[model samples]
Every structure is written in structure tokens, then in C-alpha cells.
Target chain A: MPTLRRDFESRDDLIAHYREQFPEAAAVSDWVSDTRGGRDAAEALLDNVDPVEYGRTRNHLSGAVTRLSPYLRHGVLGLAETRDAALAKVDDPSRAYKLVNELAWRDYYRRVLAEIGDAVWDDREPYKTGLDAEDYADDMPDDVTNAETGNDFVDGSVRELYETGYLHNQQRMKLAAYVVHWRRVRWQAGAAWFLSHLLDGDVASNNLSWQWVASTFSHQPYIFNQENLRQWMGGRFTGDSVGGGSPFRGEYDEIKARIFPRA
Target chain B: MNENARDKAVIWVHDEMLSLSWLGYVRRAAERTEIVGAVFVFDDTWVADERLSLKRLVFMAECLEQMPGVEVRRGDVVQEVSAFAEAHGTTRIVSLASTSPRLRRQGEQLGVDWVCEPPFVELPARIDLKRFSRYWGKAKSRVFRTTEEIMEQA
Candidate 1:
């Protein structure tokens, strides 16, 4: 066991230290996130939380997201503390309802994690897509991993996840669907990739959420049409066919029919 | 409570309890004793086995750097923590409670004292976790209320 040096001249210095210390991870990707981790950064984000706006606009990519998950995921801020902070932001408690309810999701997942332990990596239930576990690809496709998918929405999402180590919840779900449903890859592959990169990645939240999109832990598989992606993206990415090669161009029913042909 | 009791106690700072506020919580099941220092171990197993990316490591290191006076170590969590405690001339290792089984297992091996943070909401000893809606059905009523309000109601 070796003690790590804490003093740093700058963020670049700190990143270099990590690159040297964990060469394998650096070899995986030398990316660094702009999201600094600390209580000061956490509280600053907390102070700007608009519960009303969050409720109205959270589904959108550019919405009032609170960007507090990295702090929350690391236990830099406890669930109760964050809930109280959100409540204190609003005059009425109900205005904080959506934010608090979402906190309950983390709490719920944690409880599930405690109960199930390492089984978080296992499929909790059978896929609802009428596809067996063996039917899906075990490894993620290199194009999706390398951000060469040629589809704007999926490729953009892959780039975002890799570069920023963060993804909006909508993109997370849509990307999970793109992998599990459209690509016929296993949810575990997507979950593992996400866990490796996401700053806020928790085994329970990441894996179970993957299962939800994969329909292994939900009543139905989660899928969204191009219109849904476009609407929530706030026009950041087209979610359109870049060169007429996107599999996401259809309606919800059409997508379901195409991806889950057996179901 | 004599402060000397904590001259031997050290808080094991995990990723789950990075808040300075959490440092104030003395582990449950321990007598009121001051903690002399804190140590944060980057679990070698997680780093190597999980293949955690540089971005993840960098973000975590940034968080650790922000916390003043936390000794950082990278190795097997249980071994590193045990060695840290021994180097400080103590067997007592206190930490904020975490639901992470990996941490829990290491804590058991080291006999780390765990300080339980306040629950986000109170629930039955047994409740459904099969689905969010089902869990929320029970959680929503209490969730809107503060932990204090719920305790008062109870």
C-alpha cells in the first residue's frame, strides 16, 4: 500500500498524478471532467437549484438538472442533506416534491443494493423483450464504444458519455435502449461501460436503470422515437438520420415492432 | 467522555462520507469519543477489477483533495485501512455508514465503527423494492415530510 500525495499546483497537475499512478485507466482514456468534486462545488450547485423549473424541464437535455449527482453519488452530500437543501430552496415543500421524490430513487436503489449485494451485476429478471439473455451480445460494439456509430443521436451520446463522464438521464435511457434493443447488446455491457466513465456511477442506480431499459427489471422495455430524442435534446443534436443510416427514425410503435419482433 | 479515548480512534473516510459534516458523527455502537484523523483508501480491487477510467479516478482524487487532513492511500481496502490504523497506533476505525457491500465487508474485517447518517425517510422494517412506483407508494407520504416531522408523528 502506498500513500498518495494530496498537494497540487493545478487541476492539470492532479490529473497528471492520476495518469502516472493509474496507467491502465489512463490507457483506457485520458479524459478529465470539468465537474470539480467538493462540498463548495456541491453547495454552489445546490444554491442554484430551481425545483419548479426542475419539475417542468428535467427531461430536456439542457433543463435544470441540478448536476448534483456526482456529489451525491460520492456521499459528499447525503440524501437527507440534499433533500433538505432542495426543500429549503422553495417556499413550499410541494415545489421540492419532484426533487425529493427523485432522491427517494437513490435511497430505494441503495436499499435494493444492500439486499441483493453483488447481484447488482446480475440480471434481476428475464428480459421482457421476448429475447433470452443468451440472445444478446455480451460485448458492446466497437462503433458504439469508439463513437463511430454514424447515427448522430447515438454517436453524440457515446461521445458525451466518454468525454464528459456524464450524460443527461434522457440520453442515458436512450443510449441504453440503443444498445440493448437496437444493437441487441446485453444491458450489462452498457452498464459496465457507463460505470467505468460516469463520475456519478453507482452500481445500483446504473445497473438497475440499465435493466429497466433492457426490460429485465421492468414490465416493458424502454424505447423512444427520434422525435422524443429530438424534443428532449433541445436541438443540441438532431436525433435525425445523419446520412439515412439511423435506426431511430421511426415512431414508438414502429420502433417496438422493429426491435422487439419476437415480443 | 475523556478525549483520550479518541487518541486511539481514526475515522476511515470512504467515498460515501466525504462531507466534513459526516466527520462529526461518531460511529454508532461506540462510546462518545473524538476521532484523531481520517484516511481515504482507493480500493485497489475496484480500480483494477472494475477497470475504473482515468476520468473517474481524477474526479475522485479532486474530491479527496478538497477534504483537508484526510490521508490518501491506494491498495486493498481492508489491508490498507488496517495498516493505516496500526500506523496511527490504534485498532479503532470509525466511518460513516455506507450501504456498499464491498465497504461493509471490509468494515467487518477491520471492525470499523459505522456512524449512521439520518435516513431520508422512515419506512417499515419490510417494504417492497420490486419497483420504484411500489416503493414510492410507501415512501412518498413520508418523503415530503422531514425526518424530524416523521419522528414526531411516530
Candidate 2:
């Protein structure tokens, strides 16, 4: 029922819009802007996202355009009104369907939140065991923090996370697989990072999606190989590439050399 | 049974906002039924635990805390309703007819006169009739959807 639309391309732009729109209202509160670590998170994730390729990328381009989740979550915008506005703009049913699916997934996760409770946080036993112990032997907790383990992908991603507080969805999967399987750190740790940084973060979606990638809950855990990573990177894997050539480039012994030298 | 001394009303909400919606219903029903206000009940376990986020919990708490004219009781659905009914000394229960089978069964098992209130209320007579008529038309259009069906022989 209330029409409130504020548009800006940068943080300074956003600030300008806020000041212009709510001159009488108090300056935007820290609770509204900073607490979630919004600006830093967005910059981190957006770092690796090439501006030219950003609009062309498949995963989150639509999510980027609307960028209404935070507003919806905070009740600053109404869901039905937003849906009506989107449908009115786009004539393509398929695009509309895609947007609708994202929205529906929002509702689905909410329902799952109501039903599943703590079970959502539990680890996937089969995948935990199914993986070769060697696959995880070198997984260090610091892989998340150190980031500079000779893997440009991991380093760039961590930097992206530190800078933007967001990541391309595809990159999120790649990073999750890298840490969970390739590096073999726990998924919960990675999910916590996502929750801490992502401004658009919803606990149910972030946690459950992480668990899904971790192969903890699904019938089969998703252990992505180097080839899949290459495909997502648009087949771009130099030493400068995120994971450094094939995730399987070096054998189990070689990965140990690169990531876990002391072992 | 006597019509004048219904004594109490139970608002059967099938969803989250049912508390607010039922409160409105009780106000309208007061004109027709001899009753006090209403009681709101929820099945704590039936709701998804993940959805009870800190933000949502805070929001629901605010709603329940601020509600002025009605009493709110929360617990396992049947237990709360039965307990409230005994404590308040009322038999007449008012509930929204939830499309959910579980809720409908619960209502049936309660074995009391339950009024199944509609979710939406028609506009009161005092508002502009033309605006209300337009709203009524648009509401019907929004809800109606086309789907294929096969006629069956009885």
C-alpha cells in the first residue's frame, strides 16, 4: 500500500538517496545499515564478479536487478506489491517463472524452518564417511581465514567475501565444495561465514543450501570435481584461476603438498 | 440451546495473522452473538521450528503483546483451547475454517458449536459502496484461476 523506492549504484549513492528521501526522519540507523556488515560483504563478493560478465552471468543477475529481499525482510516493502510490480514489467513468462521460483524458494525455506528445526544443522553421515579420509585429512580450519593457500580461487573468493560480503551463487558452490571436499573443512564453518557476511542472508536458505552442497542431508553429497569448477569459471583455469588448474590437478599426495605442507 | 448467553468465543486461526483477523471477527460478531471477546490458540509443535527466527519471534511477540481487546493463549492446539475454555467458562467457539485437514479434525474433535469465519470481511455499510464493489470484483478476479478438469460420471 505504501510506495517507497530508493535506487542507488553505490554506497555513497545509497546514502544520498536515503538523505534525500528521509530528510525529516533520522539519519539511517547503524542497525539498518552496518550491523550486518553490508557494504564490506557486497564488495568482497562483487570483486571476482567481472562487471562486464556480471550482467551476463546466469545465477544471480535476476536477484541483482530486484535486490528487494532486504527490504521485504525488514517490512519496508510488501511482497505482494513487489510481485505485482515485477510481473507488470516483464512480459516473458519464463523469466517471470524464474523470479517466482526464487520467491517460492523463499517461502519453501521458511516452511522448512518451521518444520525441521535443529536437524537442519546436523551433518550428513553417509557423505562424511563416503569420502576418502585422505580427501579431508589436510583440511585445516585456517583454510577459511588464511585464504592464501596457493589457490587463487580460494584467495580471491575470501578477498571477495571480505570486500563484498557476497559471492556469485556458482562461486558459492565452488567455494563450499573447495572447503568441504577439496579442502575438507566443515560446512558449518563455511555457512557461518556466509551468515555473518551476506546482508540478504536468511538463516534457513543459507544453512540448508550449505548443507545441501556439503552432501550432509541429500541422498548424495555434492562433491564437485575440477571439471565442474572449470565449467563454472567459463572454463578459465590458469595458475591464477581460483582452484589452480584441475581440483584434481595434483593427486591426493600433491594436494597435501600444496594445502597441508607440514603433514 | 439458549441464544443470548453464548458466554465465550474461540477464534480458530489456521495461519499466523489469524490472531489479528479473528480479533476483527470477534468485534463484528459481537453485534450478532452474545459473547465476551475471543481467545487465540496455536499448536506450538505444528509450526516449523526453523521459521520461528528471532526476527519473526520478535514480530509475533509484538503482535501478541499489543493486542488490546482479546486474550492470547499459546500451546499444543487442543490443550490450549480446552484449557482456555474451562478457565474462561465459555462453550461457544469461533474459528476460521482452515483448509488444512489437521486443523479441521481438531475442530471436529472439540465437539462444540464452532463458527467457521471467512478470512476476509466484506466492507461495513458506511464506506463508499462503489469502491467496495470495485474491490469485490478485483478480489474475485485475483483468486480465480483456470485449470483443466474432467467431468466424471456419478
Candidate 3:
């Protein structure tokens, strides 16, 4: 094996070079400007974490989520460094506890991966919901992938994921549930799609999370009603924005009755 | 570990552990175990999958550029690593221990020296690996402890 040496005069040049090699990834060329990969940039992002705000807004679409997953996923920054940064931000260690706990989830998944190895791709346990693993379809719906799902929130999230190579954490859960439960698609299919696009996609984190939504790793399937989306995402992706109708617009009980009639 | 002994060792940096501190730690393990060179191999078998995103490749390339003198190669991981070691005149290969099953398997196959970094959490000897809460309860104290404290305990 011989060493290959090449240099980029600018970030744009690098993106262009990458595009030439992988033309199918043109949807994400614009994303390169937002994410500059290197140690210094990672440290700078870590230095600006706000634990208090993060605890409050993490569940919202426009949350104060520290977009540091790309660096953490790639090993530009370590878990200890991020945790230390969170603790340094406030007087009480407990104040940063929520942020640290989330970081710990990443570590937890890694440990699970270490133990399970390739079995992470398999369901850890049977689905808690009425349906069995064999009941789900093996392929992702083209409607979902192409952002033509007719559901405003889901479509918006899909576009965000493809165009930016990232998504809000809450949005990820909702989307995962939609794919696994609502659409009856296999969690593995959704996981692969996410891994192909997410800048922070680690196999353990992404697949295990999909399993969680699919009820294979959790107590119950994670299904969200339209009201829940409306509460968090505001009116931008509901009602009139969705042509005066939305599949996710009903009350929780109505959604439960409609989506899971057998349950 | 004599001062001159360091000159013979080669540090193998993989994509999973790109931190300078990790490399520096491995380099400083012995008085003169100065890194003769570092190598980053892009395994063709691993990257052939559809899930291997271009962004990750670009990010890895950027990371390799950060290291002062890391030689990049493309081929079988074990073969590339072995060739680099042979060319550098050192059979000893040092790398950070990784959780990836593939990387761990490669480490064993290459017979490399693996260094364990301080983990995000330190678990009890007996752990219920089924759930996150149970794991967190057992490892929370150590997880929140500073790196300095961890190093002191080590």
C-alpha cells in the first residue's frame, strides 16, 4: 500500500473533490460549509455548551442542542472531554447532569455494541406491540425517503436530514417511530437509511435507537400523535401548512385507536 | 523501556481514535518511545458498504491531515498495517483500544499493542447489560469523575 498525498486549497475544493468521487452525495454538498471537521473546531464547540439551556430546550425542534455529535461520533472529541466541558459550565454538577446523562447514553450504546457485536442488528427482544418482527416490511417507503410523505412534519424532517446530514434528536425519535410503527417498515431498513445520511451515525447508537422505537428494546412502541408534534413544532408544519389536514393532527387516544386498532 | 528503545516503536493511529492526546500518551509511555511515524489505513472491505457515507470519509481525511506525519494507505487493514510496520523497521504496533468489533478483531489479527483509554463510564464487574438505567446506576460515579481523578486512581 502506497501513501496518497493531496492538499485542498479551500473547503470548497475539498467538497468539489468529494463530489467528483461521490456524485450521488450532491444533496449534501451544501452541508460541508456548516460542518468544518478538525480538533480545534471541535474544542471551540465544546467550550460553548450551555447545560442549563440544553436541559430546557432539548426536546424542541429549535432546541439548544449542542451539535457536537459529528465530532463525538468521529473521535475528534472524547466523551470525557465533553462531560468535563459540561461540568465546567455551571456551579452545580447536577445542573449539567441532564447533558452528561445524554452523553452517557452514547457510551451505553457503545458498551452494548461491544457486548453484542453484530447482534445489534437483530432485535434484542420481541416487540412489545401487537405486531411481530416478521409483520414489518423490509424496505423503506420511497415516500418517506423522497420527502413526499404528505405529512408536513415528517417531510420537513426528512428534507433536513438529507440536506444537512443531521436532525433534531426529538425529530429523530418521531421519525423512527413513524417508519417502524406507522409505516410498518423494518427498523433495520430505517437504520441503514439513517447511517447512510447522518453525520453522527454510529451503528450502535442508530440501530439500537431504531430498535427502541420499534419496541424491540423498549417497554412499548414509541408512537407520537399529531397533537404532540403540534405542541413542540408550533404551527409551521400543521393545519393549513399541511393543506388543512394532517395524519398526525388528532388526539393521542384517537391516534392510538386508529394506528393500533388491535392494541 | 530505555530512552533509545522508543525510537524503534511505531504508533498506528486509526480513524476511530484521532485525538492528539491519545497519540501523545502512547508516544510518552516510554522515555524515548518517540513515534517513528503514524499510519491511517482506509480498509477497502469496510468502506465498500452503502452505509459508508462520503462525509465520514472526508472527515477522516481532515483528521489525518491534522497529525504531523501520518501516512495514509488504502487496502486490507491488516496488510496495510503490517506493511507500514515492516517499512518503518518496527514490529511493535501501538493503538488505542476501540469498542468496534471489526477494529478489535483487526487488532487481534495484527497482534498490536492495545492501550485502554479512560472509558466514559467505569462499570462494575457484574453488570446487567440489558438496560441503560441499570448500567448508568452502576457506572454514574466513575462516569462523572474528572479525568484527573481517574488517572490518579489508575
Choose the strongest candidate by DockQ: 1
Q: Give me the runs in candidate 3 sitting further than 4 Å from their true place.
A: A21-33, A234-236, A239-242, B1-7, B30-34
Over A24-61, each residue of candidate 1 has an lDDT whose tens digit, in order, gives: 89877778888888888888998899988999899998
TM-score for predicted model 1 compared with the true structure: 0.95
User: Model 2 off-target regions past 4 Å?
Assistant: A1-57, A60-81, A132-140, A225-227, A234-263, B1-154
Pitting candidate 1 against candidate 3, the one with the higher DockQ is 1
The TM-score, computed over Cα atoms with residue i paired to residue i, of candidate 3 is 0.91
> Where does candidate 3 chain A have its weakest 10-residue lDDT segment?
A24-33
User: Candidate 2's residue-wise lDDT over A75-115, tens digit each?
Assistant: 22233433444444444433444444454444445445545
What is the fnat of candidate 3?
0.49
Per-residue lDDT of B1-154 in model 1, one digit per residue for the tens? 2445445688898878777767665533345654667899888788877678899888888888788888999988888888877777777888877888888888899897787788888899889899999999998888886667666876
Pitting candidate 2 against candidate 3, the one with the higher TM-score is 3
Order of quality (lDDT): 1, 3, 2
Candidate 1 clash pair list: none
| lDDT to native, each model | 0.85, 0.47, 0.77
User: Candidate 3, residues B31-143: lDDT per residue as tens digits?
Assistant: 45556778888776666554456676666667666766778776788988888887877777888877877788888988877877666666666588788888888877776
Better of 1 and 3 by lDDT: 1
Error of 2 at A160 (Å): 1.5
Docking class of 3: medium
